[model samples]
Each structure stands twice: as C-alpha cells, then as structure tokens.
Target: MKVVIVDDAPRVRDRVKALLHADAPYAEVVGEAGEAQAAIRLIRDMRPDVVILDLQLVGASGIKVLRAVKLAPHAPRVIMLTNLTDLEYQITCLEAGAEYFLDKSFGFERLADILRDLARKSGPDSEERAVL
Candidate 1:
C-alpha cells in the first residue's frame, strides 16, 4: 500500500508512519506534507493509494485538501484523522468525499484496521459486495 501523510505536526506524521509500518511494514510512505500546498503537490506527484490527512492544517485546512484531492484525476482515497469530534465537522468531511473519518486520539491499530477495510472496499470485488 502507498500513502501520503499530511499533518502540520511532524510528530503526528512520524507516529502515523510508524503505526502503518507496524501494521504493514511493506507499506510505502510515498510522501509527507505539512501544509496544504505541499500536500497538494505531493498528491499530484506521488498519486498514492490512500491519504491520511489531519483536519487542522497550517493553511487551507484539511477540508480544503480533501476537496482538492477529490477533484484530482484518479485521486487517492482520503481518510481524515484528527482530534475534532464535532458532528458538523464529520458531516462536512463526508460531504467532501472523505472515505473515512477517524479520531487520532484512538489507537493506531484502529486506523490500521480502517485502512485495510478501505483497501478492500477499493478493490474490484467490493462492488459485488456493495450490491448485497
């Protein structure tokens, strides 16, 4: 699996990468971006399988990044990881086309499970299951 991590805090990025590595050591960290523009550039360049983004960014916010990513060609599916628990925030992110909304306070193991689920859903066979 390939992923681009976008978080304003370097520590958050490191932590996420470590958890992902623990889950799937083979998973590649294609890129890491701290701000919106860097995130945008990384997406365009790496075109990763999935993106783990923070809701609060240094600029433009993660919501904007979600919107931008969704608009990209063959855009990577996004999962929002943040401390924000507001219903409105969740609703807005879902509306913006986020594949998952996860709380960062939770264990990385939880996110790893979600990442697997998302990958399964992205596969071709998932369409058949969706009909059921």
Candidate 2:
C-alpha cells in the first residue's frame, strides 16, 4: 500500500514511518510533507493509496487539504491523525470525507491496524477496491 504522511513535526513523521515499517510493512511511505501546500502537491503527484494527515498544519489546516484532494479522481483514503480530539473536529473531518479521524495521543497505534486491514483487503487476490 502506497502511503503519504503529512505533519509539521519531523518527529511525528519519523515515528509514523517507523511504525509503518515495524507493523504495516506492506505499507510503503512514498512521500511526506511538513505543510499544507507541499502536502497537496506531493499527494497529487504521488497519488498514494493512503494519506496520514495532521489536522493542524504549518500555514493551512488539514481540512483545507482534505477538501482539495478528497473529491479528485481516484482520491486516496485519508486518515486524519491529529492531537485535537474534540468531537467537533472529528465530525468535521469525517464530514469532509476522511476515512478515519483519530486522536494522536490515544489512536496512534490504531493507524497500523487500519493499514494492515487495508493492505489485506487490497491485496492481489482481493477483488474489492482499496479505498472502499
């Protein structure tokens, strides 16, 4: 599974990459970005199967990035990984077409499980689409 990680913090990106390497080895991080515009451009260019995005970016919010890319042709399944665990933020991200909205503090490990499921579902023998 091709993946892209977007977070302003370098440490968060590194940790996520390490987690994927350790848990979801099938998930390949094709690219990463530290801010909204760069993320948008990288996501557009790489067309990854999944995107791990932060809710708060350097200059623009992840919502903006989500809105911009979620409707495009063959849009990737987006997982909103953020520190903001408020119900409103979760609701907004889900409404904006995020496949999953997770709290960074509590839901970090869940990301790997989600990715593993996704990888299995999208494996060569599976007939269903990956993003579904």
Candidate 3:
C-alpha cells in the first residue's frame, strides 16, 4: 500500500516512515510533507492509498488537511497521528472525516497493523471497525 506521511517534525516523519516500511516492505511511502499546502499538492498528485498525518504540522492545522483530503476524489483514509489527546480535537477530527485519530505516544507498529487491516477489510467491515 502506498502512503503519504505528513508531519512538521523531521524526526517524527522519518521514524513513522521507517517503522511502516520496516513492518511492511511493500508499503511504499510515496511522499512526505511538513505543512498543509505541500501535503495537499502531494495528495492531489499522488493519490496515495492512505495518509498518516500529524496535527502539529506547520502552517495550517491538521484538521484542514483532513477536510481537504475528504474533498478529494476517492479520498484516502486518514489516520491522524497527533500528540493532542484532547477530546475536542478528537471530536473535531472525527466530524471532519478522519478515519482514525492516533496518539503519537503509543506504539506506532500497532497503528500500522490497524492501517493494514483497514486496507484489507471491505467497506462495511471497515466502517464497523472504527477503533484507531
């Protein structure tokens, strides 16, 4: 599965990408971006299978990216990787159409497994398994 990883912190981006790549060799990380606009352009152009996004992204908020991604044709499922654990942020993200909101503090390999399962599941099945 192809993925677009967007995070403001270089270390976080690299680590997530590396971990994902290591976990699933076929999971190619097509691109990476530090801010909203660039990520938008990349997503529009690449149309990756999924997006792993960080709320602390520079320039625009990750919520905007979620909104923008939802507007795209065949919008990729978004798994929000954020440090913000507040309910407000979580609620806003769900309302905005993010598939999952994950805390960066947890084990990311588990997050990748969820992504893989989501990718493998059918529409109805995927919708039923909403835990992130």
Candidate 4:
C-alpha cells in the first residue's frame, strides 16, 4: 500500500518510516511532509493509499489538512498519530474523517498492524471489506 507520512518531527517521521520498512513490507512510504500545506499538497499529488498525519504541524493544524483532503474524490485513509491523547482531540479527528486517532507515545506500535490489515483488506484479489 502506498503511504504518506506528515509529521513535524524528523525523528518521528524517521522512526515511522523505519517501522513500516521492517514490519509492513507491503506499505511504501511515497512522500513525507513536515507541515500542513505541504502535506495537503503532497497527499493530493501522491494520492497515497494511506496517510500518517500528525495533529500539530509546523505552522498549521493537522485538522485543516484532514478536512481539506477528506473532501477529495478518492480520499485516502488517514490515521492521526499525535502526542495529544485528549478525548476531545480524538473525537474531533474521527469526526473530521480520520480512520484512526492514536496517541504517539502509546499507539505508535499499533500502526503497522493497522496498515497490514488495511493492505490485506484492500488487496486486489481479496474480497473488498468496508473500512470505517
């Protein structure tokens, strides 16, 4: 599955990329962006199957990017990975069309499993399953 990662922290981006490389071999990191506008542009241009988005960006909120892209004709599945663990933030992101809202500290490792499942469900030969 094609993947785009949008996060302000280089370390976090690198770690996520490395994790995907090691655990989710079916996932390819097609692009990376550190800010909101760039992320929106990259996601539009790349049209990746999945996007790992951060809640707080360099100069803008990830919610803005999420809202913008989710309106596209073929919107990608978005997983919000952020340090913000507040219930309000999670609800907002989910309501805004995020497939998953996860805390960066505790939920980081769950990303690969989610990606793998998505890949399996989206496989060309497999029966299509609804992803909510």
Highest lDDT model number = 4
**lDDT: the better of candidates 2 and 4:** 4
Tens-digit lDDT track of model 2 for 38-110: 9999999999988999988987999999998887787888888989878888878887778788778877789
For model 3, residues 91-111, the per-residue Cα lDDT tens digits are 898877777888888847676
- Candidate number with the higher TM-score (1 or 4): 4
lDDT of all predictions: 0.79, 0.84, 0.82, 0.86
Estimated TM-score per prediction?
0.88, 0.89, 0.91, 0.90
Compared with the true structure, model 1 gives a TM-score of 0.88
Tens digit of lDDT per residue, candidate 4, span 1-132? 899999999999999999999988989999999989999999999999989999889879999999999898888888899988687888788878888787787777898988887776653233232222
The local distance difference test score of model 2 is: 0.84
Once fitted onto the true fold, the runs of candidate 3 whose alpha carbons sit more than 4 angstroms away are 123-132
Enumerate residue pairs that collide in model 2.
Answer: none
Q: Rank the candidates by lDDT, best first.
A: 4, 2, 3, 1
In the predicted model 1, the residue pairs found to clash are: none
Q: What are the runs in model 4 whose C-alpha is more than 4 Å off?
A: 122-132
